[model samples]
Target chain A: MKKDHIRELVVLSGKGGTGKTSISASFAVLAGKAVLTDCDVDAADLHLLLRPEVEQRHAFFSGNEAVIRQQDCTGCGTCLDICRFKAINTTGASYQVDPVACEGCGVCVRFCPASAIDFPKRNCGEWMVSTTRCGPMVHAHLGIAAENSGKLVSTVREQAWCIAVDKRIPLIISDGPPGIGCPVIASMSGVSLALVVTEPTVSGLHDLQRVLALARHFSVPAAVCVNKWDINPGQTERIEAAARSAGAEVTGRIRYDRSVTQAQHQQKAVVELTTAAADDIRLVWKQTAAML
Target chain B: MVAKTHGRAARIAIASGKGGTGKTTVSLNLAAMFGAPVQLADCDVEEPNLNLFLRCEQLTSTPVTMLIPEVDANRCTGCGACGELCQFRGIVSLGTRALVFPELCHGCGGCIRVCPSGAISENPHQIGTISVGQSRTIRLVEGRLEVGVSSVSPVIRAVHQQLRDDMPAILDAPPGTSCPVTATLLGADYVLLVTDPTPFGLHDLKLAVATARTLNLPCGVVINRAGEDQVGLYQYCQAEALPVLLSLPDDRQIAEITSRGDLVAHVLPEYGLMFTELADKLQQEVLKVAGGRA
Candidate 1:
């Protein structure tokens, strides 16, 4: 039995607040029978817009935290001296590692003279499989100041792929985090296509170029859509030209509308609302679908 | 070295959990309004937009490099000690050869120390460039990460290394409560979290506040794009006992100026007073929290 390949379309924005989540939610509405994932685990906002009802939740454990065992008190500063991150703090009688400051490098744990430190896997955060009005969605919340967001993003994505396979869904739409950092890289790999949502500002163009370059570096096909193209028509045109030069197809343009925010306030996708931007987003979905 | 001569200047980091919530805007406007010598470090290496808003006079850039391990094939013992010790999966030993993934390397120098055969040597990988310039009265330091570099904390650390401790320094952190944001928030006396009055803004602001609280840094909230309808953010601030330092209304004129790479204080002089007051309040907050640490 030959199974069809699932189309994983990632909606990414190099600059934050370029309306990636808003457009992603609308795409979920338009793309029927799709598994959606919010790969922005650092500050996952797609779940806020999608209003997913959590059916299954699991704790995500990654990285290790060093704990100084006070009972084995050597009172030696060997661990503190060996530590590179300055995570060790001297208390009244013993030294303790600041978990937040600790990079989990394990230098202190391996070098402790008295074997006083206990390196334990940290419970970073939780990820959930839930159902939304759009479809099944996978999302997560990284612990405050927790490292290894890239791992968490990969976990969410892997689970999204599983859901897509189990349900035999044809599409997976991911709302990727802003920036070309670890999480963004994790969201980009192995995806069928990356839909980069950008605006008309200079920063928008600059970041879009970088993100498109990243997509190209990974050999992932990229498509660009100007979210607020009317803000600066010249920049929008310039961005389209630049994206085309960079080998990315300009999918469509979305007009800037205040009702997009109003739609967010009402916890509904823009396509569900009565706004001009909704029509624009519909056109974007049509073009994006055609490309897929 | 310059920072050391300036005495102990407070390092104030402006951050937001959500993107496009005006972290750079607040940092730039506050830097422009501060009376004392202030250095604004745009630590958002992925997209260093603060340089766009500020006009730099004398700019000098230096490359920031991280050490990635390179295996010496002649020393050919496929002991997977280096791979086992690496937490980031930076290196993997395949039979007789070990492959190194430079992008995943945290540059912790753990592999070089752990290798028994002494097969691993450090290779300098250029991650980004740190530029120092003077914009009007404010000294500017911005980090621009090279394209295709996935890791950002090293570049952010390089930018902070250029900070002068003698004067107040403002760090414009990248959005999201992750390692890059953590690196930017490190060693700051106070953090001013900039956010708007929207659902996404409020949701991520909570995460940013939690990150500050976890780090035990004193933090205040600055509500950007404050409209009449958004009351949830204010209520959350009140409930959490986090002081609302300042609020900038959702003004189209300010947006227009910002879009044109101009500071809000420059276009409207009254906003200058607001930012100056914000700086004063920040100093007070720092003193109250850290007790003369600044």
Candidate 2:
């Protein structure tokens, strides 16, 4: 059933503090020969869990930030006045820079009185193609407070897909960002399937709806799984019902266990931890494989 | 007819720019220490986890809806006025008809506002549900936006409608500095930013701080998983002149307790006293702000 161009992507919850890195790592191990990509560039933690052996690294420029030449600024202040990002600030006789406020928009480059402003492609982050025990993993790190996570996710996913094709693999299991935002949307574009892993809580249910809706919008087949279902049976049932109502397949319900943490503490997958959680995870992986 | 104001209480929202920074833990514990017949609103409608930490009885919930413009083709003039009026650019004009991207529509009614003809009619779009519940001490209200609904601001606004006077109120806000967080922070007396000690934590913590400063609200941080990540958070706070109100260390027992769907304060009795102290410090800060405003 392996297709030349098919790939499977998974998105974790938006509610951080969830054990997404650990769970994704487990899935990676189960996926053995498949290429993996960590698309949570804004806060990529799968690298921490997988300990990927980075083979190649490169600077990634998502867009351009307007850089002003001080000598040519002329103290006219037109660039400062028109910039929506307020990246440019006028001092007594000169100007100052506020990189945090800069959205990398080029309004200042066009409006500069002395034509001193130069728009350079902003180096937002670094992308890497690395080797993990599971497979070749594509991941990236977005610089502190830098936006363009959507672009980074797309970049890594594209590379991951390309690598899978080159390797003649059938699957590219991508770890997507949480929420129904731009990064999550980017993670879903053209994927054969998206497995949405969520928890059994109020916010979990709320975010699940949004993420699922996003999957529906993209016309991608989606499957849902509630991690730590034992903690809240009522909420878990509700999530299951919600998923069913939306025509999404509920792949598996994972019970809460201390082994998940123990596995993380030992730097191993839950399936290797020899616990009920591990058993549940193996079954979940089986379901994922069936999807493929 | 205009209804009474009912002397509703001021809502102080607790928010962060990133998730899992302990927003719900801080917000719920804050309500617990306020010790009055207070109302706690979880405005993170997309994920209302505030209820997970609180024991609530007697819940009343309602479905919240937003307007999705449905154009009547019979009366439509194809003047392109609706598409032109849409600020979000969600409306796509075809040669003879128009398509609407419901996700991008902010429900601002701007398109309807500008339409010369009476072709554009508002259709009810059920985005989420708002619920009211009661713990032993405080009343709880939360909004759960229907999954896949793009706009959460309206659901947040609905949660805000449950504000009550005569007691302190805490609004647990969703992470991010987007429209939903803005709606939750509106008219709040104070904003407490919960954060952690990692690189991403500090990065997003600054965003929440900037957002709070821009809104002119008194803000502070409650560092969750304190020890290993403290340096980054502390440095940022000192540089920004933001106070580090409290620190919750990386305690495995606490983590296990939370994993069991119990708030750390509930499982660790000692943290109850800590939350009380945090509340006392916050009250002093809130009073100072109020005095200045007067």
Best by DockQ: 1
lDDT measured at residue A163 in model 2 versus the true structure, 0 to 100: 83
Chain B of candidate 1 vs. true chain B, TM: 0.90
- Return the number of clashes found in candidate 2: 9
Q: What C-alpha lDDT values do all the predictions have?
A: 0.85, 0.73
Alpha-carbon error at B119 in model 2, in Å?
Answer: 26
Residue lDDT tens for model 2, A79-181: 6676544456766889855655555535466556688987778787799999988889999877644554478888888888778877787778777775666
TM-score of each: 0.91, 0.67
Summarize candidate 1's per-residue lDDT along B100-209 as a digit string, tens digits.
98877777677787788899999899889999999777999999988767667778988988988777899898888877788888857788999888888888888899
Minimum summed lDDT over a 10-residue window in model 1 chain A is located at: A1-10
User: For all the predictions, what are the DockQ values?
Assistant: 0.55, 0.12
Best by lDDT: 1
DockQ of candidate 1 relative to the true structure: 0.55
